[model samples]
Target: MRADRLVSLVLLLRQHGRLSATALARELEVSTRTVLRDIEALSAAGVPVYAERGRHGGFVLLPGFRTELTGLNPDEALALLVAGSRRGAQAFGLGSALASAMLKVVDALPESYRATAAGAAERLLIDPETDLLSRRLAAEEVPDAIAAEVLRAVFAGHKLRIHYAAAADASPEWRTVDPIGLVTVRDRGYLLATRSGADRTYRLSRILAAEELPEPAQRPDRVDLDRAWQERSTRFRSGGDQVTVLLRLDPARREELAGTALAVHAEKRDTDGWLRMEASFQDGRHAVWALWQLGLAAEALDPPWLRTALHDRATALATRYGTPS
Candidate 1:
């Protein structure tokens, strides 16, 4: 019970910032006397603990008091590392920083436990290609410390000043904005926000820097990020932009299309021979790019516009360097 109380105290202090002895005792299912003794034990053991009295305060640690992870067993260490990795990389926490911190934790463990951690990493390897674990991230881009801090600022309702780079230019321009939420679309990470009364998405890769404001931000009352995303997509799709796309495929490509995001929904259209696809997109331009990704199999099927666009593109290429006569 005392050890549980001690662990509870540490976790509570970590999560809740500070807690009065009464609150800690209530949470730990122990008496105030036990909590006081446990706190004394923690402080005596060089936990750098502090206490605050009066109505507005409680037990507090120095702001830099970091919890050590030396005492964990093998399974515990593995689970902790995996969870921390997912949080840092996927959930917008400190990717490299948390990874660095995890290395430190692993180093602090006993030699045998360190081996166990290494074994865990090797055994529990995550293949992002098949599992889609890496889908939420950009291609070959991981959330760095700056992006993680930006996410923190957003979640904490803090405004941000970011140095953003444009696709055309090498120099970064500074802009002050309130971050709304993060979205991962088509394996690319994006930060959605309103800057200068117009909604925009700034790619995480294009953000050069971000600093949080001391003043709070105005968070949306209804945080329907999905709805905002859908609205943006609907506007793009409804603008009479059609792609007369074609797929000249083998069996594998067809099967993959049905199973993957290429299709909105998949149904078996007859048994063996060939599958007819009703592929649609926002416009021919975007559709051209998407079709290009399918390599030889995809081609223009109908709609005069797509054929014209493709023909114009081909002619321009030929004119630029002379056609193969």
Candidate 2:
């Protein structure tokens, strides 16, 4: 761990030119004394590290000094390159930083592996703006200033005031929340926060405006964001006015139905090679809509209302097409 810290210290100086012991301690999550000791050690090891004693003085390396510490294997280099290719980083306002980091990684890589990794990365595509069907993926617009403030509050462990536009509401509402962390999933960003001790997840794009408050956040010093997110997701999936539907579908169409259903309760294949599944939906309309998308491949087996709805839809389609007897 100390070795990693020392490398990080060197990299930080290399990137920023000069940084004070206080700033170094904060960045490395150590004490000023520890930073001083590390600085002494680096200088002693003939690293050409020098310190200046003045109001603006700190540690600086000799001009044009660089380290040859690129110890990453080919696989590691490729993984970093692939990660840099993702659009998810754009949601957090870290696109430039990710680009800069990737450039540094490529420059530091072994000559033989560098061109190979770059060529392989070019062949992979992720989350294209438009698919073959011409359907576009939703990319929310988060203002740079708003994203910066949200990040500051999350990293600094402070409360945040945000003007949020809830989907059901026409106007944005202002609320002060204790930010736990920031998460980017797929191509969207969300702020995991709490208001009056109740957990809340704010879609970053829906946040019309934000302010990093001066007050300290009221949250546990240590939080498991993944577990918390999972708990909330579970509650959301189960808490609605859910309705279950029994379906008799072709085995090939099972995935089509399951994908649209909120939850699949059970599935079994009959002797005739048909699949019967029980699935949950938000309500009757939701169940009917999903089954309708499957067309003739799926049939509603139970809940008279669902079957009636499908029959009505089918009848309307037949009437519109005017099929011959």
**TM-score, every prediction:** 0.52, 0.68
lDDT of 2 by residue, 1-325 (tens): 4665676678677766799999999877789999999988898888888987899998998987878864544323433544644565678765544544455576566667867877886898877998789988788778878987998898789999999987736689999999998766767888999999998999999998999989999999998988988887677778778888898898888776776787898998989899988899988788888999898888898998889999998899889889765
Off by over 4 Å in 2: 1-85, 130-134, 323-325
Whole-model Cα lDDT of every candidate shown, in order: 0.63, 0.80
lDDT for model 2: 0.80
Candidate 1 — number of clashing residue pairs?
2
Candidate topping TM-score: 2
Candidate 1 lDDT tens digits, 3-117: 5346547756754578998987777657899888898999998887788878878998778666663354332343355453353244343333333335456556665586677
Q: What is the C-alpha RMSD of each candidate to the true structure, in Å?
A: 14.3, 12.4
